[model samples]
Target: MAKLPNGLISFGKNANCTLELCPLEASILQYQPSIPGNGAIIGLFALSMLIHIIQGVRWRSWDFMICMVIGCVDEIIGYVGRIMLHSNPFSFAAFVIQVVCITTAPVFFCSAIYVMLSRTINYLDRSLSHFNPKFFVWFFIPIDIVSLILQAAGGALSATQSGSGNKLGVRISMAGLILQVVTLVIFVALFIDYVVRYVRKSTARPLQSRMKLFLSFLFLSIVFVLVRCIYRIDELRDGYDGPLIRNEPLFMVLEAAMMVIAVFCLNVGHPGIVFDREPRNDAEMSYTYTGNTGAMLQPKLPSSSSE
Candidate 1:
């Protein structure tokens, strides 16, 4: 077995030392990564990139497509970073690439979600929501930005530090994760409320199949993201040496798999369902139905008398 450079510790127990400096006795999690897992993630992200491009062109969903494209690219880069780590655990470039890209990628996904939800609100009925559809875009996206900034800064700080770990970075990253959770929770609540209101108030109307599909998938994606965020919060609460942070299987399931599913769900339940509408006369305006029925309510117009 090869030994690391002098004065460096391979295990995370001594953070000041580079990972390559550790002895063969070091835990696998500290210096050895799963090549297959990282490879799979990279491939999946590439597939997602292609899929998003096709969907974007097919549906003309420019904003959604842009976000997904950025997200998939980030995931690809991050996983490539992981691959680099697998080859040489002491590689600082790999650490920074994985930490920064993966940490901030989801913010773009959240941006797409915000944009889609606002459009959904408009398509259904602007009056059904408490605030303007744009309000969701404006309000939540900014919060997402703040979270991204904090997480990126924290990841950079933690990655650059030597030995013993950076307490400030861990705390800041934890704060970012917690803030993300709070933001998602609030967004979900508002989204659900809007849906309920739309359903109840538009009881006479029937929902389009596309709209129903969009809603179902969108809701599932939200749940998946929330679960992932919660897992990250737990992982970070323990900081660098936390059990959750070092658990490879848990990270694979909670982080990689969760995000993959969420993105795919969005692709399947795309916002194109609502946005791909054709202009119709007033008598044929679109109005979504309430409850389990897939019926459309006819437009009501006053009678005209002829001489």
Candidate 2:
């Protein structure tokens, strides 16, 4: 009876036309459709990100904060893209915005997490770690940049070109995601190895001090980010039309929630908490202990015998 909007098909607009239509996106509900996740909520994520930035600055956790901020910025823009989709799902610009921003955001966050471990290695005891302090920062960060490039480029291609022209984009994005997953897995393993050895060795130290908590915090941060990355890989596995791509609820929890939690974890798991190491003063301490009879001494409270 009524003419539908272009590609509206009860999804919203031509761009939202799905392979399947639900009661929500169906005929009647179209008149009073459910609001998609957008705006205030995205603003909330942005706010969370902003807070992390503040905390990062205050705490001087430069590495951790940068990672969280990048992820949050990606999310804020990604959700804004979704907002665009809600307005006109058929809008190519909106689709491209979301794809490019969201897909590549986590890479920065992961890189940040990787660097935290470098700080942790220093805090724990550099000698025991298999790699040098520079290894963590130099090795993985470049790799992370590579992944970001591939993903951003892929998403750009996919957004601009429709048909099979985008196939390369999809494949490239997949490659980036896969590489990121692998990188994080390797990082997690190395992190665990470092921690295990530290614990075993620490058993010999005085139990009075509890520095292991720093390591524990670092571990939690890693796990949260790793789990979030896994979810993203799955979501992107089948491309945009895939099952996970459309599932908003799962995305909220596994993706958004996990990342927020991970950022906060990094806050708690910061390295400065333990690495407040005082400089070793062998020469000064030795001098103090051996008393330089030739030079100067506190005139030995000269009063004792005379008094």
Candidate 3:
């Protein structure tokens, strides 16, 4: 039996061992992942992906639809890894798949949310925003890419090593998770600021009921994702063998349930629902500013000539 520097047995791809041959504690996770729980999560994500595909095509929201579908697919694959882990807790391939896919899936989700904010800002009043609407896409998307790279690299590194070498990979992954949390915090702050400014500076009519509902659900989705990111950071803080990582129930609640709610919330608040309406003609779209009052005449169609 080969042992690594960390005093744990080296169970790499070639390690010939079974649950009966070795103690359960010898496995990296020390327990089999729950098949039923992972399968349920996969089903939910698949359903969300299907709905997104339909909505995106119908509304012509190509970018949002693509991002969401990819994220859901990534999530499904990650959970499938967990299901594989249930059959063999020491499976290195399963560990790598789950770690990399699950860690990076939210980056896609965040990118989708970032684009929505940019679109929302433009739809409302771009002038009220502190930065250009395109800035959100250009800046945040690159940051998300960086986070994804770091997490994927870390997972790869961990899969290739055994024992104490795993700590370095965990640290790198933690850095990525921390960056994600910081990014979310900044994004939420900017979103709040934009909303406040829009409320104060615009003289437009109050938001319609549907728009109000859309905004509410969108914000809730961000909050749920933020909560999940925070939980992941804490879970990885103590490394792979940490207590939190070993706690399957907590993972189900914080990671799985949080993501489930976040995705469903996006479905309810789909941007296309509000932004895909028929465009008004130029005559009905004209605006006349009321000087210094921050007000403008609402656009309306011209009256009939006979009248």
Candidate 4:
């Protein structure tokens, strides 16, 4: 097989200098990828995507379901790339697919969450929120788009420059992850503030049980994603050859497991639960806040057709 002039490991062909000649330090996949772990994640994401499809169709939640399906599909492809690494650790294609797909998958999930929150605000009293429901969708989705672009670009750079001792790619990826974390924190703060304001200021109106469950699971999913993002920032901060990057088990737990759990949580917290009924027209949907009691009039109940 043809080899590098400087004794560098030759790829796409077998040689005596296979894994033996290449030290673990020089290779990103120091150990063969965990077959069981990667396989399990792939299966989970596939199942999640199927479930999301069924639910989306059943509930007619097209946009939210589309976002969720995209995220799950990305995760599945990423794990399949990991499975490829198990067979050929030196496969550059596998590395690029896993890095780019997995790093940017959460952007879709974030979009779904942002849309749900905006709808939730419209479903509830819009007056309680700091901005209009459309504001959340327009503002945060662009931020998420920016973050996704940065992460994808960084992953591509890192993958192309793998084993070249390049720190620039790592820095770019770190910047993307850092921006994601910051954006999520701000989102959580806004979500919590709106909820608190809604609870404290509104008059006691009978709230649906499904609404309660929806909020609970949505909150849980956000927390899970936030935790995963933080872990990623730490892992990427020291570059690909860092100690944290080498630990396959840690990655399985923090990255794969966290995202799987988060998406499943979204399944449970599907927006359909609260948004099952058709929304009223803008005129009937408007709420008038009463300053005398710090309360707003309740929204009109759904029509029989909606039920």
Candidate 5:
């Protein structure tokens, strides 16, 4: 690899560069991606994906399972890209894989969350919600899809270009992240409002232990994802060569660890654990507390109408 007049190694899809030929600082990331760290992340996401498959099968939660599985796979592939970058940071294929996969992966996860909230509203009391519970699904999922497209497109565009074109890609990706943040903020507000309304209802029963646990972990997962999005927006604001993007520790904590915790929290807060046996008709479902166990008992529907 030959150095340009600026004393930096020339880099591009056509560049023939390797760690042996170029200094680490000359790589786009300015440092080697750690294999050990990324490998551990892959292992964790793989485990979570497996668990999600089993849980989804057992409880018949196909949508949730599919979202989680896809998200985990995306994370795994993205980390594998990082591992490749460890060997040769100038690898354009590796750069594209990590950028696109990791950035868009969370869109699937957010879709899952959006669906769950709708289901939860239906499970609790749809009447208490400001808008139809179905609104979450009909509105948010499409928004997530838009965000996914922008981020993926931006990453691909950025990776394949240089100069001003690269900056344009980063800006587009940043726009996607900003949209996601805005959506989450709106979601949190509606969620809190609904919870407050539900609690204040005269006929409402106190949440059972299982319900409490599920809600707690679900909310925690949302927080983790929100924090990660904010961090990414900041990291990408200055394009690929930004200082925040170069800071591996911040990336590990805010991006990698936050996602790990969020995925696990979803596992713990899985709606199937509580709602699997409940009536599928969100409006007609009724809950009664069993003695001492704090478990919700749903009245069985007639055989002709059973789901």
Candidate 6:
């Protein structure tokens, strides 16, 4: 069997050390417990996601349902990797699991965000907004996809190498997070612009209380996702073995907590509450729980609206 170099794993005299990186056994704390909290935190969020997904599906919030499902699954796998850490902190498989799972999870959130902009465009006066919602999908989503690919490939590449090559993985993941933050900043700004115009317009539809609840949840999801992403960016500042990067408790609060709460937000903000039973000029304006073809909504004065 080949031996690894200092600060390296999975590599020997012949293996590549540039990308494939693994935690060193010397760094493993065999004497002290390497308790990992990510599992519990992520597990709760998965539960939240499951509940919201059921609700979104029932409401036919196809976009929300898909987003919640994918994010939750990714978290579950990442936390499972953390559990493996509790068993053996230096386990290379566990490291990769956590790395890949957590790194790509946000892509799903970005996807849902992209879908939401399109729906909002259809719901309100798109002419009032600064940019077309389609731009978000056409431009930002493709960027997000690219980010996902980079982070995933980087993690895979680093996992195959030995040593602090793990730093390369962190760098790639950080790039993705930074891109997401920039895109989200633009997204929130665009939405806010529409919101202001909608509020000022004389023909604006009155928002129902139920829809408000959904909006609250959705807003919370966005905020939390942003917070988590920022935390990740900060954590990776010094690369993989940086003191800030490996702190498990911080991950529990910022990363896992943010994502779990987001799932709950979907539960309240689901389209079902906003559309079902709300009267509109056209049947198409109503949320079609029964899968009616006429359920398409058009922006107009709300009719006999109930929140």
Best by TM-score: 5
By lDDT rank, best first, the candidates go 5, 3, 4, 1, 6, 2
Tens-digit lDDT string for candidate 1 (1-307):
1345556645333434444445423432464568999899888878877988997888677778898899889888998888887776656677778878888788788888877667767656677778877788789989988998898888787766644457778777778878888988888899889888877873424566777888898888888888888898787786776777677788899999999888989888877655664323345553433211121223434447777
Error of 2 at 169 (Å): 1.2
Candidate 4, 102-152: lDDT as tens digits: 999988998888776677766666778888778888888898998898888
Q: What is the Cα-based TM-score of model 6?
A: 0.79
Off by over 4 Å in 2: 1-36, 202-213, 275-307
User: TM-score ranking from best to worst?
Assistant: 5, 3, 4, 1, 6, 2
- Candidates' lDDT values, in order? 0.74, 0.64, 0.80, 0.77, 0.83, 0.65
lDDT of 3 at 42: 97
Candidate 6 lDDT, tens digit per residue, 1-307?
1345674543223333332253433332221123445646666866778776677767676666777688778878887877775655556677678778887887787677666665555554566766765666788778878878877877666555555666676677778788888878877777667777877987766665775675667677778888988888897786654565556556667877787776666666765675454444233454322331123454444478677
TM-score quality measure for candidate 1: 0.84
The better-scoring model by TM-score among 2 and 5 is 5
Root-mean-square deviation per candidate = 6.1, 9.1, 5.5, 6.2, 5.5, 6.0
**Candidate 1: where are CA atoms >4 Å away?**
1-5, 9-21, 24-28, 162-165, 202-204, 278-307
TM-score of 3: 0.88
Single out the weakest 10-residue window by summed lDDT for candidate 5: 288-297
Task: Residues 65-175, candidate 5: write the lDDT tens digits.
Answer: 999999999999999999998888888789889999999898888988888777777677777888877788889999999999999989888887888988888888988
31 Cα displacement, candidate 3 (Å): 1.2
Candidate 3 segments exceeding 4 Å error: 1-10, 278-307
Model 3 steric clash pairs: none
Judging by lDDT, tell me the better candidate of 5 and 6. Answer: 5
Cα displacement (angstroms), candidate 6, residue 252, comes to 1.2
Q: Candidates 3 and 4: which is better by lDDT?
A: 3
